[model samples]
Target: MAANNGLRYKDKVTIVTGGSKGIGLGVVQVFVKNGAKVVFCARREAEGKEVEADLNKLGIGEALFIPCDVSKEEEIKNLIEKTVAKYGRIDCLVNNAGYHPPHMPIDDFSSDDFRELLNVNLVSYFIAAKYALPYLRKVEGNIINMSSLVGQIGQFGAVTYVATKGGISAMTRALSIDEAKYNVRVNSVSPGNVWTPMWNSGAQATPNPEKTIENGANSQLIGRYGTLEESGTACLFLAADATFCTGIDLNLSGGAELNYGIKTMRGEKELPF
Candidate 1:
């Protein structure tokens, strides 16, 4: 197939969680730009409303913002119900809402803390998928779960977060198999060091924020953080273009995991050739 044009998803309906900011915002923007009717949610009503207003100004597509806290089952149920009531059908679900706390050692976290994080990060995805499946099945739609590269590899002092992401990827694969009979595709995107508000806050919390961000950029072979637009574009590809792909965790790592060695700074040395 040729690439998706600007209006490829014209009139398609998509639901994105955590769409008020960061990667979720990017996803909402891309879908709207491609002419998808996007219903996005976040816990903060103010931010959600602002994003809705801004996206609506583009005039290419429509955007609806609903205040939702994914950790609550009732809220998630209501979110799905409201989307269906308004749009009459759903074509895609992007389970992207997540919570990541500051890095903490395993000993510092209690079992409850781990479970609580799971509720926000992993379990919500399951709930969203469960509720969205009927509508998705009817339209042969797809689900895209936001995972992280640390889920595949390991990250020190972030055991709880890693566990949830790993669970998401595994659940995505399993759900894909079961949903195949219904023609509902399930997949995930595992991103590494995407430059979002969360990344900025984390960097700012460090003693030397500038150096922290620089190190993060240098960690990737591409020598920079992934942009919000890039993240959005990746999700767009999986949703609209990768028709044959399912149950796979697409890595958006910028080659961060390609090898194990010191990274060379760009323009710092001549090539061996």
Candidate 2:
């Protein structure tokens, strides 16, 4: 027999939560380009409709967008059910929906903010996996959880967000072991900084968008932040090509993970105070 065509997820049915925009949209774009039938979801119906139209115009494999709030178990269930109903099976699930509230000191952080962070970042993954497990198991499908470098090394003023990231990392390990026997793979991708609508939107309000981008870029050892295209490539590899990869977190942090303390200095030389 010929060698297996292992790198491609062609014709694979995929679902990406929070896919209306940002890193999630990036993942969806890549999947569509690579010949997968993909369905994505977000709570914003207008954005979802617009992206759906844009993807359809590409004439790639069919794309669908469902209105969903991944934080709620019922919504998660509906998101997966609708996807499977549309595509027949789920070969891959990309849990990419996330939120990062305004940064605040730990003591100053509200309990509500902490709960929102956990619900969106950590619990949503569990909710999606629970509903998608049956279909995923049928095809030995894979799950890719979106995480962040902040979780690995806590961000100075984002306690809640950091906690969720840390929890997802731990969850990835345990869940991977749990799903192994069922032939379903679970992995995570922790991105450093990817320039997407999310980043751009925030930058618009800043005094200097270019400087913000530059500072963000310089924080990485690679001397630049990431693009959605780059992050999407990582997602594609993890979701389809990594057959034996599970319980692992592939950090696409532009080498930021390698140099922890340097980014905080803002490319400044220390004064001999």
Candidate 3:
């Protein structure tokens, strides 16, 4: 399918938040490959510079790395400013930055935890959109919010993370309706179990890490976790190809979302007793 003007976004400009690593980086790579000029930002200077260098070496598309904290309104504004200054217009915004801490029950969660998740996962999108909307309006662009499966089907102990993702889903829907008149589109991709840095960190720390993740993997119909490429492909579909689609939640959960609430029962032989 054609992406922007001629099906594929050959010269479109895109901004990807949290572009230094993980799914965000994956999205950046895909946009670059598909002929989009990508501007990505993250808090870490080293990673940003490294990724910038890597993409520059490819010589397929231009990549600009801006050091940014997505939660800060001023930084978000500056990010959009820099991108427009260089690219002249914004065609798409990928709100992909997020924070997921170790699992904790709602009662055990601290106030700081809630604030942190809101700043990164939910509020950041608001800030980014506030600044990017005008440029997007110029081109009738699109916004792709990164959501999670846990939000749709609440996890046992990840209350704060799930809440933030749930908020993103709702916000995307609301924003879509509000922005449609301007011909702009807003949508979200809900990834289930993706094997990115976040999952790696969780896996290494979990008790019997390998076995724990293995069991989690088996729960999915694919019998495996998702890759950065998989999530990136989904983002590309929403951003460039889905011209008539908006306010939709595309599940990249490998069908795991369909198999809900079925955990290993107690006293089962699978227990590590």
Backbone clashes in each candidate structure, one number apiece?
0, 0, 4
Query: What lDDT score is found at residue 189 in candidate 3?
Result: 94
Tell me which of candidates 1 and 2 scores higher on TM-score: 1
Candidate 3 displacement at residue 179 in angstroms: 0.4
Looking at candidate 1, what is the lDDT of residue 4?
46
Which residue pairs does candidate 1 place in steric collision?
none
lDDT per residue as tens, model 1, 35-152: 9999999999999999999999998889999999999999999999999999999999999999787776788999999999999999999999999999999999999999999999
- Please give me the total number of clashing residue pairs in predicted model 1: 0
Please report the candidate that would top TM-score against the real structure.
Answer: 1
The ten-residue window of minimal lDDT in model 2 covers 264-273
Q: After superposition, how far is residue 18 of candidate 2 from its true place, in Å?
A: 1.1
Instruction: Specify the poorest-scoring 10-residue window by lDDT in model 1.
Output: 264-273
lDDT tens digits, residues 162-251, model 3?
Answer: 899999999999999999999999999998888888887877777688787897687578889888888888998888678889999999
For each candidate, give its TM-score against the true structure.
Answer: 0.93, 0.90, 0.92
lDDT of each candidate versus the true structure: 0.91, 0.84, 0.87
Off by over 4 Å in 3: 1-7, 264-273
Model 1 residue 178 distance off true place after TM-score fit, in angstroms: 0.2
